[model samples]
Target: MSLFCHRIEVKSVQTAGIIIEYNPMHDGHLYLLEQVRAQLGADTAFVGVMSGNFVQRGDFALLRKHARARAAVESGVDLVLELPLPWAVASAERFARGGVEILSATGVVTHLAFGSECGDAAALERLAEALHCEAFPALLRRELERGDSFPAARQRALAQLTSPKDAALLSDPNNILGVEYCKALLQKKSAIRPLTVRRAGTPYHGTDLVGAQPSATLLRTLLRSGERDRALALMPPVVRRVYEAEEAAGRAPVFRENAERAMLARLRSMTEADFARLDEGREGLYRRLYETSRSACSIEALLDETKTRRYARTRLSRMVLWAYLGLEPAAFPRQVPYLRVLAANGRGRELLGRMRKCAGLPILTKPADVRELPPVAGELFRQEVRATDLYTLAYPDLFAAAGGTEWREGPVILP
Candidate 1:
């Protein structure tokens, strides 16, 4: 089809990169990779990314990162990098920063690619520019009081605050993330040119399969039901063994019903002063958090009870994660210095071996090497381990392999 075959050839990939969670490899992603390669050229190296135990949309990856990475390689990507938990758990801005930082750190990556509703590189950049302006935030607050979702409020705020040329974003979560990608690229002032492609056939939040590809949301629903046979059917053939092995060993992915209880308990146990240290819990957010926790039984309950015009659900999600990690509210890390490798394909494995010759940061393969990270990063990593331990509680099957057991150095790979 002309639509999926559209290609942008990269004459030479100074470096072409993508930040992603191939939660399950699907046709939409197959199209995305085709676009990335066409623009960057056939010779252009494809860099894949796989999210860890905790994922961006607030859950576990149905198949582990390594399995997912190998699947990307089989599908046509040349390399796969891990979006480490420290980054995988944070807010969009933080997630974007860590992602962009790692990609830019590759020293050769010249362009960053993403999917968007608008699909115009020039327009997204302008929105990013306005977002950084002085008047945007003030106007943003005014529109937010209309009780639109935080995304809608930001878009309307941008509409009134900026020129007529700037079309306000219409509350799309994928497009919103695309905006964050632009924001991070600009923030770092990196040389990586930003590119965007229009998403096709289905909306990101759609739950049905648009064609050969189903939304990650739909795939998650199947996995959540413990229907591996159904979910695995959509995945690349290479990932089947991994899932089957996990199933046989009674080690599989499952989302916990009460993963946030400890975080809620942390919030409940803390004084108002304690909540102030989290990233979004500043500016009296802790006050709301404390008040909400009094009547709520869960994190979603707290959000439902207290979310208002000024606070967004995304902010609340980050706040819960931040509190669980015991993050100092005031300080979020500026960059991810350690570009650790949680998983890789054969091509990616080669890249890791060669990166030491030209890279700026350490490329790690195991958790032990990450021990020297700064206080927040180290603590955050530890929280991820605890989160992993906590995550395993949801699946009785996983205990046979890595239960409440501590995480070890090597990756848990399926042969």
Candidate 2:
């Protein structure tokens, strides 16, 4: 049978893998989860590989990762595993790869489900295949040389190699990520089949709060602006409760600006060599960042000075964020080392039973469990510990921002 046919004809219980940041779980996110169950089966388990303290967008998550994971579990996900610091803040390609690797390592996940504008897995796969063609690289280089940003250049190259309709998929944020998911799955030769649900309500980056499904960007804006009720209205009831409880504890609505001075202090103290060490592009981007840091008083100013047509603002922001975290570009592992459980429901417990027997990577449900794993994995977990400590500094209340919470907190278990 064809792979597409085989993907949907799975005989065993389906466990759908979702890659998420869920900066805040809103109705749109809930709709995607429900859609997965609707299309796959009501009993289908959801295993989410979520970005931890930081997100792909190069900012602190609107809420702590554990709280967000709790919201996810309460909303319907069976298990939520962390995507880890390195991969969490990396480029889209690496972020997708890390999440995909985690789910593939689980061994129990039957499919990868995500929201996309196109919502056509086969189309994304075709685009993925086209990207892998030998001719695509030369075309990409041509576009890059024309002074386009990496994302813009890649889209331009794809447009050149494929029909406008196929290349147009890259224009939408969700479809771009969907294509990356397909590419990662193909590159790894993973057994997990790919699936997509058409995103409902608001567009990916939409800032308007008019629709049934407002974007997470809008929600974050509302939360940071002290509009709690407005933000809560967009989230699921369970998620709203979770945020309310977190806010009561002085832990909700963590923003990057809250910790700006600390990040600025860290960046200002770094040497040119240090910046160079963290440069991924090897194209003098970090050098520009270093020069900009000497005069730029705020993060926004630094980003503005460093950003150019060739370097997207988000790319520069990731660099600055990584610099503050002391994470060098070369330090990121190509594959996620371990599955760190962040939150789980009762169904997640059963899923864990199956994972113990079949998971390709080590699973860490407790902080102490790292001692039994390889040193590499242990060190990686330690980085996450440090990252959490820094993340807490962004909390509204410094009393709740104490270090060592990473080592103290285990998975959020729900009844």
Candidate 3:
């Protein structure tokens, strides 16, 4: 019954890792955590590898990572690990790969769980296998040549090579990422088994709050619209409390538009060659950015000017973020170099003790440790620092906008 390369010993307690952004922890996230915990038994250790200040959607977190991680720990997760900025703001393939790699490095984790629309592990694995088939690459290239976006082309190729049902899974955001998680597990030859819980309530992009478990999108909409009470109602009490505390401290509710001026300034300063080196920058897209930045006065304007059928808004947004951060395509490492602890509870501290013995990579716990990393890792950490500095500028309070928080702040420890 084991899907992993190594069989779990009967006497050992199981540990499961979840990959999440928790951009703002809501009831839906709590549901997934509770469901997975129930399935694995109360004794199972729950670990989460979460995105940092930036998230996969090419936006800053509604709240900082420390606040979000604290909420996750209070809700049910024992430990939270930081997924570095490069991968945090990457495409789905790289995002899932980075998350799975970090979870696998922990060694004690035997299973990887995610929320998916289909929640069928077997079907997801089949789709993952199809992606690796020898024919997939040629078909994908054909779709790309036809001017389809990468996601659109990949879905079309999967539909043609496999079935419409399998391809349709990609339409559901969670299912698409779930498939990538399985693919990463296989690619890494990881010993962790993959699992999925059914996503409740609306689709990932649904904007209206409708049930006990609402989409994060809907929650964000409510919060941004000044419907704080309504948004709080859709989250656990502890999560709500953390969100309130962070807001009181002037560090919550950061939006992409907060950095509108800085973003425009950075783009205006960059040349076509500079944009060409950003992730997803290619085929003269850099030239488009260069031309557009001259007249585009707002982030919305820049996006409208540069976006095309070939370049999705999310992809363009990620590219813009990379350009703003001065990150080149070669900046990221081929593989993740370290496991960083962002937040942990008492149980999490115990798990860290275990990781020290079995972790394949270094487990970083302090800002000073950045000095000890190899050249590549040090550069990656510097990118994170720079990103954090820029992120603080988005804080509602000017005093909170002062940089260097990355060095001053420590992991959130929940009692």
Worst lDDT 10-window in candidate 3: 1-10
**Of 2 and 3, the candidate ranking higher by TM-score:** 2
- Output the better candidate (1/3) by lDDT: 3
Model 1 clash number: 13
Clashes of each: 13, 0, 0
Sequence-dependent TM-score of model 3: 0.95
- Which pairs clash (backbone N, Cα, C closer than 3 Å) in model 3? none
Per-prediction TM-score to the true structure, in the order listed: 0.82, 0.96, 0.95
What C-alpha lDDT, on a 0 to 100 scale, does residue 370 get in candidate 1? Answer: 64
In model 2, which runs have C-alpha deviations exceeding 4 angstroms?
1-9
Model 2 lDDT on a 0 to 1 scale: 0.88
Candidate 2, after superposition: displacement of residue 35 in Å? 1.2
- For candidate 1, give the lDDT of residue 412: 29
Q: Name the top TM-score candidate.
A: 2
- Which rank order by TM-score, best down to worst? 2, 3, 1
Q: How many backbone clashes does candidate 3 have?
A: 0
In model 3, the runs with Cα more than 4 Å from the true position are 1-6, 9-12, 279-281
Model 1 stretches with alpha carbons more than 4 Å out: 1-14, 141-149, 161-166, 225-229, 239-241, 258-273, 279-283, 295-302, 371-383, 401-415
Q: Write the per-residue lDDT of candidate 1 for residues 1-415, one digit (tens) a residue.
A: 1111213344544446788887666667777777877776766666645566667655556655555665667666666667767677677777887788888776656678888877787777777777777898888878766766667677777776555445455466766787788888777777678878888755777776676767777777777776657878976565556566666765555453435566667778877666666635345777787778776887778888777866776577666665665555445455665666655556566566667777677766677766776675566566557766655654546345364343464542322
